[model samples]
Target chain A: MRRALKVIVLGVWLLITLFPLYWIIVTSLKPKAEIFTLPIKYWPGNVTFEHYADLFSFADFGAYLLNSLLVSLVAAAGVTVIGVLGGYTLARFSFPGRGALMLAFLVTQMLPLFIALGPLYLLMSDLDLLNRLAGLMLVYVAMLVPFSTIIMRGFYERVPVALEEAAQVDGASRIVAMVRVVIPVMLPGIAATFIFAFVQCWNELFLAITFIDSEDAKTIPVAMNSFITQYDIDWGSMAAATVVSVLPTLVLFAAIRRYIVEGLTAGAVKG
Target chain B: MRPAFTLRKARFIALCLLPGVVFVVLFTYYPMIRGMVIAFQRYNLFDITSTPFVGLENFRAVLAEDRFWTALRNTGTWVAVSLFFQFFLGFGLALLLRRHFRGRGLYQAWVFFPWAMSGFLIGLLWRWMFNGQFGVINDLLLRTGIIDQRIGFLATPGWAMTSVIVANVWYGVTFFAIMIMAALQSVPKELYEAADVDGASKLRQFWHVTLPHIRPTLALIVLLRIIWILNFPDLIYSMTGGGPAGSTDIITTFLIQQVIGGDYGRGGAVGLLILGLLLAFSVFYMNATRFEKAR
Candidate 1:
């Protein structure tokens, strides 16, 4: 009886958790007429891809998708590179003010980015970066670098220092030892940090909406937000766009799920 | 033995750290400081020709508004109610998911998938799902003989808050489940075996063994989630736009409105207030965590 109850409980929670996702996918595939029937169709009666076609044809969704992809990619790569250097320095080297620097990174993680939104807008406007993809990338890199650095630092600490010493003993210079020896071992960590940063940048909406006003520069979230704000929200197309927008993050997340769980645990609880 | 610190080493260290430091200072700190400065000025986005310092005027204006207080009150409800449900339900979930089972990995992945999603998109999904006329929720309720009529979940003020909180609870439970599960795993099997040897019942073992083990993590995560939930306006923004007379408007959403309305001064004021609130909580949280560590 207890075992049966436990299974039922888990099953119910699972349904609650996944129903929205299932509903959206099903709703996206449903024909326009079938979407708003008297009794809501549990499943789509007639599947159609017209909404997906409409997403690209009628709306600026193609541009939004490209912009989201480009910005998230560049920013993720930029933050990961910066995170590698910073994380390595913090991990391997001890210098004056290093403690303060680490503390600063931690404090930045605690801060709400919304507190900086207004001035960030003004600063971007002054730099003529408003409505620009590069500008958005810069903001994302800055926003993401702190957590990425911490995650990388955790990864570095796990690898014994003796490896680097062994490399140096083998006539390898410090830089060469790091590049050839340490980095190879940290590839999984690097990929995890990169994907984590990528997902964050892709999912970002507030800064994207605030900074990117032009249709050409708008990201996926901003485009989807605009879609909903229209007088007559095209539920079919919105659902379709949402599915497309979510796919990259879902795929990337599935790839790095284990690393993310570990990273988050370390970064949040221990850090 | 490691080499002594040298000029070349210092140079290399500086080289390694400079890019990140510069980026952070240029983007995060610079804007944050500028935002604080803007709070004291007459910085309207419409007319930026002259933004002279006006000490505490923006703060004063924001404080005087009835909407700000309403948002503040709503923020309390939003965070508390959401956190309450999220913690308990998530704790239950973590307990249930602790055991090894067939397809556990896939089940975990499927359940935690919502956490990977964008807040805005989640809001949009929930908004449509809660729609009055054609919403699945209402349809399900009606078909199941729960409600006789279609009810606008987002249209009514009380229901609007409930609706948003429900979405938040759904989205956030996974996080607590994941964190708590991680914390649970860290408790050694030996400890549980010892408790079992002591003839502790399942409930008592949970109280004596599990509770103490994960309390520190629980406290920290709860604090973090409070700040995050307060900062999270994306869900509420896309869901109701803090609609039906600002019923669901948290302080962050309130700040977003100030920015969207082209009142940078007021927005900055709101931002400072949020910063102050979080900082205060963070100080207390840090001290509490330190106490936990010491114990």
Candidate 2:
């Protein structure tokens, strides 16, 4: 009986969590008239991809998708590449102000993305980079580096220095030792950092909305805004768009979900 | 092969590290320092540096502005309310999920999904859910006979704040649950078994065993989230556009207005003020946590 009750409770919560997601998928497939039917049909009797087709045909969604892909991909690659090198240095070398430098990096990460909003905007304007994809890439990369570096630094700090030294003593170069030894061992951290950077870039909103205005340059979140104006909501198409938008992230989550969960827990508790 | 991975003598490490340092300095610290100067300069609405400095002028105007106070108050309220619920609900939900169960992985993903969503999207989603006329909430509430009329949740001041809080709590709870659940799972099971053998109740066991074990995790969450909650902007911007009567204005939104209003100096002043408060909170939270640990 207790076991039955536990399952029931879990079932209820799961339904609550999954319904909105389910609602979007079902609503997306349903025709407009059926969407608002009195009983609110939980399933679509007529499943069609009209809304999805409309989403791609009537909208610049393809551009937004490419932009989102480019910005996030660039940010992920940039943050990881930079983070790996800097993180390695911080982890291995004991330079003066090392602790202070690490603390400063944490402080930078702590600062709200908008803390420098005014100046960053002015600087962007001055450089004539107001809506440039390259500019957005620059901001995303800078914003993500500290978090990535911190994670990478922790992973690098853990590798047995003796192993690296032994290899070096055998006449292997430092670069080779790091490449062959430190990096392979740190793959999990590297993977986690990449996902972390990509998610952050993808999820960024305030700056994205504020900076980018052109149809060709818009990302998914910004592109989706036209569906829900203050007056009326295009629920069906909006739901369809939302699902399409969420699909990639869902795929991303499934891929790195394990790394993300473990790293997040370790990051908060250990750091 | 011999010198490809050469030692400390090689300049490769410095070369490798240079690009990242340049990136951070140019994008992060440069803007930070430059923003400080903007707080002083008149910031030629058209020409930037051509404008003359007007020391303390921008600060005075910002302090005198009524909307600035509104933004600050709402920001404080927002930070306090979000931090409170995020901890309680997150902890509560984490405890609920701690027990081993079927489809645990699926449930975990469902709860964790919102945190991964862009704030812009979450803002848009909640806006639909809270729509005054055709919203899912109004439909449900009306069907249940809870109210005769729609609540106008994001329009009225009292409800507007509540609306943002509810949305924030929805997303915030998952963050806490994910973090806390991990730490909770790491806890040894023997302690619970030992407590059961000692005839201790679940509540007592939770208070004495689970609470202490996860205090560090809780403290860390609280410290970090205080800053994050304070900084979050889309929660304000999308929901109400800082709404009905500037009722939901927060510092970040206020800064946006300053930028749009062409008052970069005043906006920069607000920026600096916000940065100061953020720093204070960080130090305060860290010290307090340290004090609690020491005692």
Candidate 3:
């Protein structure tokens, strides 16, 4: 009887959760007439790629996808480099400003990014970086790096001091020890941090929309929003836009799912 | 502090930590320091430096505005409502997932799907779904005999704020679920087994054992979630753009339109207000939690 209640409750939650997802998929496949029907249709009446086609022809959907891909990948790679190295240092070494710096990172990590939004915009404007992909990258890096570093710090903290000392005990250079010994154990953690950074950059909205206005640099979400701003939205097309926007997020989440799982575990439980 | 022997080790570590430190200092710390300074001046859009320092002018202006109170009320309401649903639903779902169930993996992946969906995209999706004339929600309700007429979910005052909260809850639930699930999983299986052997039912076990075990994690997750959601401008920005009557306007959204829309001084004041609330809440929560434990 106890087990039965668990099963029932679990089943109902699944229905509530997946129903919107199913709706998204169905709306993507449905014709316009069936999308906003008299009764809300659970199943698509007739499947069509017409909306997807419309998105491609009218908007820069491909460019947005490419931009999102490039940014997510590059930003993840950059953050991992900083996170792993900085995190390793914070974990292993006893330095003067170490505690203060860690506290600083924590402060930056949790503050609302919008608090800096106004001033950062003005600064970016001064530097002639507004509407540039590079500017967006800078903001993303600033926002995401602290998190990645924090994540890396946790992973590094879990490693013992003896290992690195032993590596140096064998007359290995500091850099060499990092590359050869320390990193091998920390690779899974590093990979997890990378996945976390990658997904965040991919899905970031507020600053991206604020900063990147030009078609040349638009990410997937902004371009997707263009479809939504229309008076008579082609529901099928908007659905396609959602599909396109979600593709990289899905792929990154799937490919790095194991690492992603680990990162989230760290962030929630141990963090 | 063995200086001579570990000097090189110290320098190497400092070098490693420097690059990241410089960035945080420049971007996060610098902006905060600058925001405090900006709060003093009547920071005009067309000429920033040219604008004279009007001591406490911005603060006074912000306080005097009726909209500031509305924003405070809206933001406070948003945070409370969002946190309430997010924690409860998330914890509930995590509890459900703890059971031995078929397709749990698939269920989790699907459940986590919204978290991956862009905040901007979710905003747009909800906006479309809630559209009055052709929206799926209104159509569904009328067809189901729930309401006689199409309700303007976004346009009306009472409904607008509630609508934004509902959409926020939808996106927020995934976040809390993932956090709570990780915490729940880390509870040693042996503990549960021992509890079962001792004849403690699930409810008792959850209250006595599980709650205390995961308390710290629960606190941290809630703290982090509140900070993040409170500052988030994009989700609200894209959803209703602070809505039909400014009823749904929050601190972040208010700051954005005011500051980013070129009301630098007033917006900066609003930003400071938000910063104060977050700081106050965090300190208060930590104190209360610690005080409760001490008692």
Which structure among the candidates has the greatest TM-score?
1
Residues forming the 10-long window of minimal summed lDDT in candidate 1 chain B: B215-224
Per-prediction TM-score:
0.97, 0.90, 0.91
Clashes of 3: 0
- Candidate lDDT values, in order: 0.89, 0.77, 0.76
Best by DockQ: 1
The candidates, ranked best first by lDDT, are 1, 2, 3
lDDT of 1 at B230: 87
Off by over 4 Å in 1: A266-271, B285-295
Q: Write the per-residue lDDT of candidate 2 for residues A53-152, one digit (tens) a residue.
A: 8888888778888999899999889989999998888777765556876776776767655656667777778788778888898888877666777788
- Candidate 3 Cα deviation (angstroms), residue B6: 2.3
Candidate 2 residue-wise lDDT, B1-295, digit = tens: 2234345534555766676777777778888787788888787465555778899888888899898899899998998998798888778778778887778887787767775666666776777678776567777788899998888998899898888888888778877888888889877999999999999998899999988887877788787777777777876777787887988888888887777666777777888888888878778888998898777
The list of candidate 3 runs beyond 4 A from truth reads A36-40, A160-166, A225-234, A259-271, B1-5, B47-49, B100-102, B186-199
Between candidates 1 and 3, the DockQ winner: 1
TM-score for chain A of every candidate model? 0.95, 0.92, 0.91
TM-score for predicted model 1 compared with the true structure: 0.97
Which candidate model has the greater TM-score, 2 or 3? 3
